[model samples]
Target: MNILTEILLQAERTPNAAAIVQFGRGSGCSFDEEILCSYRTLVEQAQGLCTRILRRVAADAQVGVVMGNSAEWVLADLALMLAGCTQVPVPLAFSAPQAGWLLQNCAVVLTDASGAMRLQEWLETGLDLPRNTMHVVFGHYQQQSAAAPTSRAALSGPDRIVKVVHTSGTTFRPKGVRIRRDGLDALVSALWQRASKDDYRRYLSLVPFSLLIEQVTAIYLPLTSGGALLLPPADMLPLGSPGVIAADRLEIIRAARASALTLTPALVEALAAQAIRLAGRADALHALFGRPTAPLLAAGGAPVANQTLTTLDQLGIPVYQGYGLSENSSVATWNHRGANRIGTVGQPLPHVEVRVADDGELCLRSTSLFAGYSNDDPSSCIVDDDGWLHTGDLATRDSEGFVTITGRKKTLIITANGRNVSPEWLESAYRSVPGVLHVIVYGDDRQFLGGIFVVADRSRADEIRLAIADYARRHLSEIEHIHTPLLIEHSPDVMAQLFTVTGRPRRDAIAPFLSLQKDPSVHEHP
Candidate 1:
């Protein structure tokens, strides 16, 4: 069944019940305006927008949705699904060149007025668009009173491709992952089943809707459960940089009294910084995160430091770490209320089958796996003949079935002595330092490990370096210890090029930018 059908059913059951809550932005500690959209009102808005869009484009044409996250973004998503058009969610992180490549064959591109203006600026900057493609602003479409009827015939098909999601990585370009209706449905169903009963009342969206995990948890899960999808006001925090969620933005969660949140590792780090400031006091934690009310705080995207998780746990915040990729449809394994594992990324979900390959790479088989890459890229051939998707992530599964991700297949650092070390563990250790923004370990062919750090305060570089070195001494092996440290100030421009859209450091691309300083230890080795 089409996922839009789930929303339609919910609208029929509780037409007047609040389906979405939009918080208004203000400079004060507490928000001022709260706009609630009933199920019926949401459906009407989606239907009207869908009707307007269908009139403009051909059947099954690709429609690019580019906008800042908001209620309108959610409405546009539902509208596109109800109309049976393929949606390409363009995240703000994508450069004009990347977005152009993804939307090459699209018939129309939909965006807010501000997004449209940005597109125009890109065009002036020499971004080439398909001659037939038209750029349209969503605000031009008006909501109608009568709901536009969904044509079931247009949506039903054996080959179900609903959305083309783009994956973020260190690759030269972004890969478009084709996600089917059945896959998304299965993922949402499994997540809803694993969700905490106490915290399932509302799902808060802190990330962009363009992200597939945010799309599933923030949009589909809430719609299917007949709960509210809470969105922060656009003006609450400025958007532009990747992985830079404002510390004050957490106030939206407290103001909304939201229960569930899908947090990126960077956001978890931000919360960790706040917790440190509050000294893990119960009252302060309650004031910042709505402790007793917030239950399902799942962290993913990157490896959240164990220290950060410990801090959040001490503050009475429930932080569940999960592991997945775009190929596995967002989440393959997760820690839920029933099975809470701290360091490991819990057990596989009911619909997922996971195994450790001979080489220690994680392999997965699930109904939610993507059909294929949009360009038929051979790299998508990670799936072997037997059907297990060979996830490049190296992992280990315990007797209890909990999977601990060790590192990535491509990111394994081989030292000159032929000893292979996972940079992830070492990087996580450095990230645990309070002022460290990002750290990239570089010692692929060197005698010892070295790294460059993007710290919040470069003036305290010595202090940060000592803290990391002390942590390494206690937690990491001698080979994994960082022998050389290059500290750079935390600026958006510097981070934009050094880090991927998902906040992972671009190690291969970063070495050229750093000035190498010979360590006394490295000279002794040679």
Candidate 2:
């Protein structure tokens, strides 16, 4: 069955139940809270939008979606599926040039109210978008209403192209992944089968709905399971918000009474911190204020550290971590309640087969694997001729079948002496140090590992430095010991370079700083 069928099924089952809650710029709207939209209303909106989109573009045409996290974004995505266009979700944090690149690459473009404004600004500034390609703004496109006809009908199966999700542009040019309806169906079905039998009636989403992972789990999964999806207000969890703060997210999670939440590791850290704070005040706070409980919390995108897991456990929140890439429909392996391991991403979900190569590169075969990269590149981004998705993550699986991701294939740091080191492992170890806000390890062609450290609170630098030294002495080997940590007064300008939108470090962008520190002139002068 197609993923869109889930929405139609949910509408049939519970037409009056809440479909989506969109947190907007000033405030927000909820289907159940403010404006009551029966599932039928949502289905109709999708159908109307689909009719309008297909009128302008062909079936199997790639349609770019440029919008922030909102109900409009979700509706546009569903509409694209209904219309038989491949939906390409561009990162909202992308620069104007990046946005233009995506638009040029895709066959047509679709934007919500805010994205149209942003795109218009870029267009006025001379970003050359394709002429034949039309732009369908989600709400109230004034000047171009006469350009296209709008209708309300679903497309035939042969017309559908489910999605074309772009990879995070960290090291290479972003590639658009083409997914078919069957691939999406397999992923959602696998997830549903594994989900708790108890009703997952309410969900709170923090990530942008444009992200395929969020699209599948937060929007589609909830709808398929007959659940309510709540989005946080735009201002509270803005794209520009610092990646580390948990207070804003905790507010939404509590307010929505979200039984399930999907988060990146950065958000997971914040959640863990919030959970610890709650656990710390559990006794006194229980008497003064009633404690709120959320049973299921799942985190992915990046690895969650051991410390964070322990903290979540202490807070009585069941936090599970999963592992996947955009090529695999966002999840291949996940840790669930009964089969969870502390440091592993857990076993592969049913019907997904994971294997580690001799050199430890993780590989998989799954029904959710993409059809191919957009533009039909023969040099596959993931799938080989044999159909295995070569996930570039280096991992280890235990006897019990738990998978632990050690590092990325591109992220492996080779020492000048030929020793292979995983920088991520070292970074995770360094973060365990008190007052270390961020750490990036570098030793690409050097004899020893060195790092650029961002101290959490500058005033406590001396104490932290000493504590870190002591911890390293006790825990790490002489080679594993940090050669020297250069302390920065402030966090690196990651956002300025678009290395990270959230608090997670962009290791590749920061690698150049390592070269600067390693320059021989400084030591020669000394």
Candidate 3:
């Protein structure tokens, strides 16, 4: 059955149950916003959107979703599915040039309140589009007299492409991964099954819905399971807020009484710090959620440091790390909440097969894998003959089937002495040092390994450096020790360089900086 049916089924079972809670921005709405329509509201809204979209575009044509994390974003996604149109989620952080590339690639586009203003600005500036391309704003434009392009009679089956999500574009040019309905169904079902096992009740979403994984877990999974989604408060800062204190996130958890939350490594670190600041008075926070003192914290989007995990664990949070790329449709392998290993991403989820190549690269096969990349040849990303999605991440599996990600194969550093070092390992170790916010390890084609460290707490920089040095000396061999930690005062221009959202360092994009920093005159230390 189609994935959209899951929403329909949930609405039928518990129409009054809270479906979505959108926080931040100006408006806040609960599941009861349209009480009478209930679950039918989702179907009706999507149907309205679908009817409007299909009137101007082919059934299989791509429609871009450019918005932040909000209810409008979720509605647009469901509407696209019901309309049988391929949805493309454009990051709200995308620049005009980047947005233009996606717009040119897709046949049609949709923008929500958050993104509509910017898209209009770009469009009014005379952004060129294909002759037949169309762009529509979600709430702004309701009626059009244009002739219908294709009727529902010509619509393809559900197995056709449903959505397209672009990669973070850190290393290479951004590429779109095309997701099909069947794949989404499998993913949503697997997530619901897992949530059922864990008794996942309330979901609090902070990740932008533009992400495919966020779409599945934060939106679809909750709806499928007949659970509630608690959103952040309207005054809460965005994920990258300069003043985003732990209290900000704590308020959301308390307000939503959220039992489940998914966040990036950075947010995890921040939340851990907040927990510490609470000084063990977590009862108010815990009580607000109607959950035990411990909450299930699932972290993805980046590799979390062991120290951060250990800290959160000590603070009564169950931390689970998982690994997935846009190509695999969000999560191929995840650490179950109760069945977690300290440094591993846990085991492969149900119906997913994960194996390590002879070279230690992780390979996966799953029903949730994307159909292919858009605009380019499908084979360029997915080699259909192998039936395995090649995850560039290198990993090692234990006898118990737990997977520990070592590093990205493409980012592995080969020292001048021919020893292979996983920069991720070094960076993970560095984050254990207090006051260090971000660390990038580099020694490629160099005599020794070194790193660029960005410290959030500048006052403790000296102390952190000394502590890191002591830790490295105690735990690492001479080769693994960084000769010196270069402290960066300013954040890297990631967006300008097209590295990542949330300002995470892109190893590939920083390679040039690494090369320039390496001094050939320095001799290797034996």
Question: Cα deviation of 41 in candidate 3 (Å)?
Answer: 1.9
Error of 3 at 192 (Å): 2.7
For candidate 1, give the lDDT of residue 182. 84
| Residues forming the 10-long window of minimal summed lDDT in candidate 3 | 29-38
Query: Each candidate: how many clashes?
Result: 0, 0, 1
Q: Rate the local accuracy (lDDT) of all candidates.
A: 0.71, 0.64, 0.64
Candidate 1 lDDT, 452-493, residue by residue in tens: 788999889788878887766454434456645777789988
Kindly list the per-residue Cα lDDT of model 2 for residues 242-273, writing each as its tens digit: 23244345555544656676765655666666
Best by lDDT: 1
- Per-residue lDDT of model 3, residues 1-526, tens digit only: 3456657676767767666655443345322212112454554555566677777877777777776666667677776766677887766555455567766766677765666765765566475743353444334333232322232322335367777777633322346787777777777677654556234457787666766777777777667667666656534434532223333555556555576777766566667776677645747346434465655677765566688788777766767887776677788778875678989998888868988989997899988888877656322344448798777778999998899988765655654322335565567767777777777877654545667777776667678779778876544534467756766544556233523666556766665664455443132332
TM-score of each prediction: 0.75, 0.71, 0.70
Index of the highest-TM-score prediction: 1
**Model 2 ranges with Cα > 4 A deviation:** 23-36, 105-107, 130-160, 169-172, 197-199, 238-246, 280-292, 375-382, 412-526
- Candidate 2 has its poorest 10 consecutive residues by lDDT at 143-152
